[model samples]
Target: MELKKSSSKQEEVEEIRTIEKPIDDSFLITWESPTDPKNPKNWPYARRWVQLVIVSVFALLGPMASSMVAPCLDQIAERFHIENSTEKALVLSIYLLVFAISPMISAPLSEIFGRRILLQAGNVIFIVFNMACGLARTKAQMYIFRFLAGFGSATPMGLGSGTISDLFTPEERGRAVAVMSLAPLLGPTIGPVISGFIAEYTTYKWIFWSTTIFSGFVFALSIPFLTETYPKTLLGRKARKLNKIEKTLKYHTEWRLEHIPQRKLVAPALMRPLKMLTTQPVVILCAGYMAIQYGILYLVLTTYPVLWTHDYNERPSIAGLHYIAPGLGLILGSQASGIFIDKTFRFLKKRNNGKMAPEFRVPVILLGTMFFPTGLFVYGWTAKYHTHWIGPDIGAAMFNVGLMLGWRGIQTYLIDTFIIYAASSTAVACCIRSLAAFGFPLFGQTLYDHLGYGWGNSLLAFIVLGSSIITCSILWFGGKRLRAMSDMVIFKDE
Candidate 1:
């Protein structure tokens, strides 16, 4: 009876979709009216928020999988009989390696297939492989399973920004993006905190199993929660429907251009992120900047266990609780920054007589830079001297405050700058940041071992300070000029 009612309801929707039209020659299939419910942008507040919540949840789970095992590394090393430090870290960073490459594929595939299918499909893939990680019999199995799970993880990271663009106008995007960005940003820091007590009390295998359980719940929720938000795909569906009834009806899009074969679109679309990374300085430089910040974050997270476990002699569960410091910073910073971002944009636009641009986000980002290195410096020295635990935690919190501010600003800038191509552009940024995340922790143990807490962390701080200042300044003063020069962006101040 439930199935019958659902099938009948679905048929009713299909009928409604086909109802509108005064057919004519060369009519473009678009929203029947500005208020059309089929249009994602026109969705009600309750529905849009539901979709956003689902995307954010999906986004969080992948990153959660990446780091939830942090407190259980010793157990994993024992089980796998791993001796080499690099290889041990590889067990953790290996997932991120696939995160770097998979988005380049997933983003383009979403462009072709639409966002809903790929995202839901990604959840299913993640569920299967993540479950495999729990049951792995060897190091080889662990590495291979982790690497495959990351492909599932990459979908939401790659395509989430495009979904935001689809559902909200530029003026309404800042808060939505903050919600989007906060999920993945805080996932790594919070994952261990949640899993830490579990690891202390139970087998490390629970990490993967519990995660799979949570993810399966999320996957069930996503089946009905998500919808296709890509405009081109929506319009294409409309065109197909109209064409079915009228034999002569033909709707045109860039995809239907005579010279560019349908099959050829796939290759260029797949390569678009790489092209943007190489040819566009704003993209490459901003991506590089974000990469540095992300690398530093993973470096700190991987090495944090060392600080507490060895130096401070804290239990694994207690050490896990310390992750809350950075996690809190992300939450507080994102909340405050989210509100200010839209207000700043609106203020800057008014001052410019109703002109709006990505550069408006630069001021908030600059404020973030001041806080990150300072946190690193404080965290380094406090740990080096073995001061009260609160000191280092305080510093960690401060650094993440800076991180949230800067990362959010850059993400919003990228979305605004590449609205139409947001998925591809964000994929480029995610690729670089994921690469950095993968490589950074491999050297984290070495950096701290050789230089000790103070100098090693100080070295990282200086690097972050330099990169943050240079890239942010360039984005502010010169971003407009660069955007004007890019073939992809059509900039108009007026």
Candidate 2:
């Protein structure tokens, strides 16, 4: 027993010494210089914009597929003999339900395999399952296909912001995030308008078919342009190339392919977002704020059919045209926010002697919060009194503007806060917000039915006003301190 103990101690000491030894300089992989051209951060402005445009287009296609079918839910319900209101709503809601869940898988996988492969493959999955949705004969089949398609569609949401963060620095990221984030919001709104026309002119199946073609186009463009941007991934490739060389060079990169873990860090990667969600107050508040916005957006999308077809006695095709107002609001708001967000951040940074904080973005959200309830009030009251059709449209458009502004603010904040883990952080935000989006519409018809648009939306406005005030206050006064308290990775300087 004494001899064995001594031998174990000697082995332990040797192991410790081995670990303490410095890694050879040759094995160390690093950028060649501060201005290395291969680094995404060093890419030319035109090239960076080209990458962003490609990603943004891919981003738009997924959500377009998700909500384009909104206008066809009634036709789907009648054909499938779906009588239960919840079941009818489930046809749409279930897609969102899966959307909330799939990011758990997709976001972490993107981190492991790099963004391009997962994104392109996920789009393909989305294409296949979404097309299958059109062919679904039974209610069960529709539910399954929609869920699977949603599972696939969620990849862009999970990964797109990370891609933006990869290409742009925090100082330059605001507008890029705005463009990437706008895709999902804009896609849902634009979808129903097109679907309405298709619903009027062609079979509902064409909706799925048309989107498939569009997504295919986006996918083809992505294939050639969406290069791998993950640093470790690029280094791994470099290391592999070095190992393949037959001659031993006197001077060569020290990076070793074997140093990277053979097994994917699956368990820890999967748990990170949930861990952040539970431990970080900033994530909770921002995610909750975004969720409310998403819920409201979907609520409007779900009820447009009811509002125009039943309340105003408009033809379905014309009713679909009304979605254009909100779509315009989204575009204008996003564009305006993009232009201003960077300016806001820069002006604040300059005031503080060139230091920027995530809290700097909160003021924009304050403006949005005010617009949120005011627009709701305008929309709800106008629809209640049977005013001019344009009244409700204008109100809805205002609400969308508020939504886009708030979304842009929070999204930029999240990407900035969780810079290294942007994908995972975004996935968490998307999860809760997607849940709100899923459940909100399930109860939308009933809420409007019981309370009327004026009172119902008025109640929503009050709740939003209260929540916005609280969110702004917390982030404004305590955001930096709260970030300090958490163990999550945060950049100390922009």
TM-score of each: 0.92, 0.91
Candidate 2, position 60, lDDT: 82
Compare the candidates by lDDT and give the number of the best one.
1
- Cα RMSD, model 2: 8.6
Cα lDDT computed for each candidate against the true fold: 0.82, 0.78
After superposition, which runs of candidate 2 have C-alpha atoms over 4 Å from their true positions?
1-26, 243-258
How displaced is residue 374 in candidate 2, in Å?
A: 1.1
lDDT of 1 by residue, 139-159 (tens): 999999999888897789988
Q: Deviation in angstroms for 486 in model 1?
A: 1.7
> Taking the tens digit of each residue's C-alpha lDDT, what string does model 2 give over 1-494?
01111221222221111112234444444455444687676688888888878777777876787787788887888899989989988988898998788876788777767788878888898899989988999999999998988888788888877787677866677789778877888888788889988888888888888888888888888877778876545655665566557333332333232345636467777888889789987788888988888888788689988899899998778888998888888887888788778889889877987566888888878878877788899999999998999998898889888888888888888877776577888888999999999999988988899999999899888878888888889888998887886677555543
